[model samples]
Structures are given as C-alpha cells and as structure tokens.
Target: MKLVIVMLGLCCYSALASAGDNSKGKELFQTNCAACHGEHGEGKHGVAPRLAGDASRWSLKLFERAVLSGVDDNGRKLKLMMPHWQNGSFKGDNGNAPSKEEIAAIHQYLKHPR
Candidate 1:
C-alpha cells in the first residue's frame, strides 16, 4: 500500500512536470497548428478557417470533438492536414499525454482571448 501510494505520487508529479502551460501551448500552436490555423489562430491558411474568436461560440464539446476527432460538430472536416493531439499534447523537447485538466486549460485559453 505504501509502495502504491509512492508510485501514484510519482506519477502525479511527472504529469504536472510535463503538464503544458499556455506559453508552451502558444509555442506548440505556432509550430504545429499555426501553419494551417495561422499564427494567432486567425485562420486564412487556404485550408484552415479562422481560429480567433471561434471558440467563444463553441461549447467544450464542439472543441474537443474537433480536436480529437478531426471533425467539427457540424460534420465538416477540419485541419486534416495536421496531426491530432486529442488524447495528449506535445511541446518543446518533450511529448506527453495531456491530462483532462490540461485540455481544459487549453480550451479555456482559446475560449477567451486577450
């Protein structure tokens, strides 16, 4: 039981350690999502739609479905040219599975812009 607790604790720490912050997310967005989505998510990538101000209109459901499944709620295809990062995320020198908490963070960031 003690060993189990220790292992679980370590897992939690590792997750938090790799957990993405927005600065990291923005950087990731630039390199991975920006080409198609545009740097500020402003869209106009010829294939991609404008991303800025898009999330405010969407429920998290819409957002998640689009990100994970590569399809929008309206059943239109989206950014198929890009890789999926639904179950996880990658940034910088490391790749990791983003926890639900992390996804929520990214969602919130997108939903509200500066």
Candidate 2:
C-alpha cells in the first residue's frame, strides 16, 4: 500500500511538472521575449524575425531546443544576442529564464496570438 501511494504521488508530481499554462507563458513572454520579438510577435523589421505564426508551426521539441540552445528550426545558430534559457539557467537582468514547463506554456500561447 505504501508503494502504491508513492507511485501515485510520483505520477501526480510528474503530471504537475509537465503541465503548461498559457497565462504564465504570456507573462513570461511579455517580460522576456516581447522586447526583441515584439509585443504581438510582429518582429522588429530586421532585428528579429516574426515568431507569431512561425513558431507555432514548429514542434514542441524543436521549439524547446531553439529557446534553450539559441538554435533555429533550420539548424542554424541564432545570433549571440539571443539568450539560451536552458532548463531555467538563463541569466539576464530582465526576468527569469523560464523552465521547461514555462517554455511549453510559451509555445501554447504562441499558437494563438492575442
């Protein structure tokens, strides 16, 4: 019985960890991503490409990799200015880097821009 309880508890914890919340994503994006990417993801002319429609087409895995590693979907390395938010290890003056779950939430929010 104790073993079953532990297993169930672990499962619940895992589920909570994996779940993504778009509201949180929006907040993170506003603080972290909006500056370069634009508040509405419109992109800054030549500064940064538009991510509103583009990022939504990417798979979650690829999106996570790009955000964490500063790589694009085409395997090209992004500019140095792009910060790597690997596992929430991204250090910057503006805001928190974003955990894996937060990345998921960002992806979800990007799917449908407001």
Candidate 3:
C-alpha cells in the first residue's frame, strides 16, 4: 500500500512538472510573437508562415532550434525575419530573451490556442 501510494505520488509530480503553463505562454506570445505571428498565430502571408498548425508537428528540440538558432526542422536556415532568441538580438519587453521553460509554455499554447 505504501509503495503504491508513493508511485502514484511520483506520477502526479511528473505530470505536473511536464505540463506547460498556457496562460503565461499566451501572454508571452502576445508580447513577443503576436506582432508578427498575429493574435492567434494566423501569420502574415509573405512575411511569416502561419504558426497555428505548422508547429504542432514539431518536436520540442526542433521548436527550440528554430527559435534560438533560426534553424527549421529540416535543418535549413529559416527566413531572415525569424529572430534568434538566444543571441540576445531580439529582446522582449523585459529586455531579455525567453527562457527554455517560457519557450515550452509558448509551444504548449501554440499547440492548442484558445
């Protein structure tokens, strides 16, 4: 009984840790990405591709590479308009690039935009 309880507790904790915060993601997207990606990631035609369903197929590592290194899932360079967040070239309102956790949150929000 004790072992079962401990296992259950571990599972709950793992779930909580893996879940991303969508609300915070929405706020971050609005501040940093909405300008280019649109309010709901509808995206501009010639400027940027729609992010809504496009990113759903990407793995977290691919998403991170695209955001931090301007590299696409195919390992090709993305458009010049895509900012490399890790290089500090594109600062948010807080004057800093988004952290990995924040990026994960943004991904979660993009995966299922409300």
Candidate 4:
C-alpha cells in the first residue's frame, strides 16, 4: 500500500510537470499578456519583443524566471515597463498574477505557434 501510494504520488507530480494546455494558455495570455505582447504575441513595436518565436526557445526555468522576476535568464533586468509578476502583481495591474502551473501552460502555447 505504501509503495502504491508513493508511485501514485510520483505519477501525479510527473504529469503536472509535463502538462501544458494551450487552450488554457491562450486564455491566460490574452488576459494577462496580450496588452503589451500583442493579440498574437507579435509584440508592439518598440514596446515588447515578439514572443512567439523568441519565447519558445526559452527553457521552462528561464520563462518562469522572466515572468516572476522581470529579468532575463542571464540575470539582466528587463525593460522598466516589464512588470514582475512574482509578487502577484504586474506593474500595479492589481495583483493579477498567474501561478507557476498556469505559466507552464503559456510556455507550451508559445512553443507551438499557430
């Protein structure tokens, strides 16, 4: 019984780690990121960089750090306009920050562009 429970726990964790729903990701992206990144992530000229191709290359860790830390993988600060969602707010957007799992879904969506 203990072994079975352990196996089940491991399976659940693995599933979560690998899971990424593009549909849900689209919704989240539209609500949270579209304003700056553009409707299809093509980006706003000189405001935000295109994320479709660029973001897909980022590792999950790097993506998560950027979302939460407002810093690039190299630890350099992003543009001042980029908001840090780690503290559950994006530049005073009133605490509307996505959880890590949601960000994973967004990552998956970004990786597979239409």
Enumerate clash totals for all models, in the order shown. 0, 0, 0, 0
Clashing pairs for model 1 are: none
Work out the TM-score per prediction: 0.58, 0.71, 0.75, 0.72
lDDT of 2 by residue, 69-104 (tens): 989999999897887776354334345555777787
Per-residue lDDT of 14-109 in model 4, one digit per residue for the tens? 887666436877777777888999877878997898888887679999999998888887889998788777767533345677677888877777
Please state every model's RMSD to the true fold in angstroms.
Answer: 7.4, 5.4, 3.4, 5.1
Residue 10's C-alpha lDDT in candidate 1? 100
Candidate 3 local accuracy as lDDT? 0.80
- lDDT (10s digit) by residue, model 1, range 1-114: 999999999999988866533664565456566677766777764667776688536787777667776777687876657456764465553666545554455565554433
Worst 10 residues of 2 by lDDT: 87-96
Model 3 C-alpha lDDT per residue in residues 57-108, reported as the tens digit of each score: 5998899889889999899998878888887633354667668888887777
The whole-model lDDT of each prediction reads 0.63, 0.78, 0.80, 0.79
Q: Output the number of the TM-score-best candidate.
A: 3
Q: Report the C-alpha displacement of residue 87, candidate 1, in angstroms.
A: 7.4
Relative to the unseen true structure, what is the C-alpha lDDT of residue 50 in candidate 3, on a scale of 0 to 100? Answer: 76
Alpha-carbon RMSD, candidate 1: 7.4
lDDT score of residue 62 within candidate 4? 94
Any residue pairs clashing in model 3, and if so which? none
**Candidate 4 regions off by >4 Å?**
1-21, 89-97
